[model samples]
Target: MAGTLKVGLIGCGNVVDYGHRPALLALKDVELVALADITPARRLIGKAWFRLRERQLYADYRQLLALPEVEAVVVAVPQKFRPRIVLDAFAAGKHVLSEKPLSNVPAVAAQLVAAARHSGLQLAMTHNYHFLPEYQKLKQLLSQGLIGAVRVLTLHFLGVIDYPGAAEYQADWRHTLAAGGGVLMDMIHAVYLAEWLAGAPAQQVMAFVDALQYAGREPVIEDLALLQIAFPRAYAAIHMGWGAGVGGLDISGSDGHIRLRYKQHQSGGFNQPIELYSVDSDWRRSDHAIPNLDTHEANIARSFTQLWADFRDAIREGRAPIAPAAAGARALEIVLGAYASAVCGRVISLPLAAADPVYQKGIAGIAELEAWAGSKTKAAGLFGLRA
Candidate 1:
């Protein structure tokens, strides 16, 4: 709590390797004091990346939490196992920053919210889209009523997991349905960002999800998703896929509209400017200078720099983080709600009741996938599969 906040990382996975390390290094007030990973190879990889001493390496995160030096923790592990680790960190009296989706299941996510509130510790979620410069500009414009009375928003993302040689899907947990896999997992940022830009929670959703291209290799998880979300006094459509094409957003308001463009750089791609356009009366169109934030790397680490700064400040001030667990929870609701609607061929309402199965257990709780979208999910339980 004093000089650089001593931080421990719980998962030495891809996001940690590429994103968290860079963000932590970029923050003057934060220190990467120690790291814990289950995989020995991953632990060594992190040590080599951060030049961590042997004493700084840990296989069990609990041991890292036991250390008095660590003041904060970043839960970058898979969504399924994160609830336990996050709870443990709070129990250890450390503040926490968790990866997106909160958890694959909502019940577990609820537990985290309860624990963090009772523990009186800040639990920040990595809903970092709001930090991007372009998004910031758009938010500013809307706040000024540049695009008055936002009525609808449509976000589009098209492209396969364009990792060179398909690296993202190759032997990755993201390819597994039970792990909260596919476009929803990969692009839940869009859901959260939509809410941020729209200024309201989705009231209902109807969607279609399928694995259009990866039928042979990874047949269970969905790669293509088209979701329609209904908001009070507004509407939103989000389409993302592991297919191919251009992607962006078109937001229409009573006065005008805003268009945004972005690309997901797969392999070591640097930051790219986000192009935004504004249209006004008399068919007047405004050409805008590019925004500086890079969309290519959220999970890769670039965007989290601001996210970390906010988290650090919030922890110090005894205030709520910029992006809290509630935002993440809403995104999960829209996501799992989409899955439920797609499965049942019915328009699923949002902020689902506690008794709704998907509200409690995520996509695995859906009982009729074969009837509507017909996804080939082989999920066995909350945590395991038949693999």
Candidate 2:
């Protein structure tokens, strides 16, 4: 509505404080107009931290959206509530930038996409890992045919879901499936990366999910999931867990191979390093580790800032957002397909229908797991096996 993009942020949670707030503040073209959270303390904290006028704080998101000055809304709420907020923001004639795993469920994600499309508003899902320097370099290499024809992508991302020093309250919400807890949500970066590298649609998926070991706390969701996705051109595998472990991604192609290794911690500081092996005169290897580089955290912030800028540009230009709502819906579909395959003991095809038994069973299983996990005190391992 004005020369500067007026941004209203919803959900002043850990992510908002650590990631989005600083990044948005750094962007010159954007103004942080308002903030909304269910908790009064969080709203107060954000207002104090950002030095916003008292009137800019609201307890309800609907009230935030009703503000004429708020041209765009960033839905950084928990994954379970993302779909509703995204749809509502679009309906309110505001562009939306949502945190990852667009929705906890696929069906709701699809509805949100449809609503955004019909309303002709921007909807962007923040998958920040793709913007990392290493990833960007890898993409450039692949596009330039340095890796030749991509044949396989393997990603192993594992870390302790409940580590020491983490807030007890944070664990409470994360341990529940209703709050979108799982290796699925935690390790979704790998899934999206694999799909991005493969440059092909995921055709089918087969997954084995279990509630393996946790850090002395019951996980209301599957802590470990091994997913095998068959894309049109290449096959991919993702091994994700929430226990003591180390993980990375390996991409093998016709002529070269690249590996990115890191210790998985949810917050940041897991840059790891990238190793490349290429066929030249002889097989040569090189490591491109930046000196004292905190690429992971920097990339996360940069991705959000760039994503917000792109949303504003799209709106001003009357064009679709960089990662449109449909793409977000498709990403959720791919994730749901993996879950369905794990539940039904079969490969689930793409474009899943509403009447599919696997989808029904998947939802039921998630619900049951959540209920069972909440009542247990000890860390519940994978649903079917050890992590």
TM-scores for all candidates: the values are 0.89, 0.86
Alpha-carbon lDDT of model 1: 0.76
- List the candidate 2 regions with Cα displacement exceeding 4 Å: 160-171, 215-218, 263-269, 274-282, 286-295, 357-362, 365-387
Clashing pairs in 1: 19-300, 19-301, 160-242, 160-243
Residues 35-122 of candidate 2 have per-residue lDDT tens digits of 9988787888889878899899998999999998899988987777787788778878998888877876666777777887788777
Q: What is the C-alpha RMSD of each candidate to the true structure, in Å?
A: 4.0, 4.6
Worst lDDT run of 10 residues, candidate 1, spans 378-387
lDDT, each prediction: 0.76, 0.69
Structural RMSD, model 2: 4.6
| Alpha carbon deviation, residue 245, candidate 1 (Å) | 2.3
> Candidate 2 at 382: error in angstroms?
7.2
- Per-residue lDDT, model 1, residue 23, is 90
Candidate 1 lDDT by residue in tens digits, 1-387 = 666888999888776656688899888889898999887878888899888998999989999999998999999877778888998999899999999878987777887888899999989998876776666777888899987888889877665353321123233667666567567666788888888878888899988776656666645566777899988878889887875455777889999988877545211123343567889855589866755644566533656888898999898888898788888888888888877766667898888778887777776677523344343232311112222
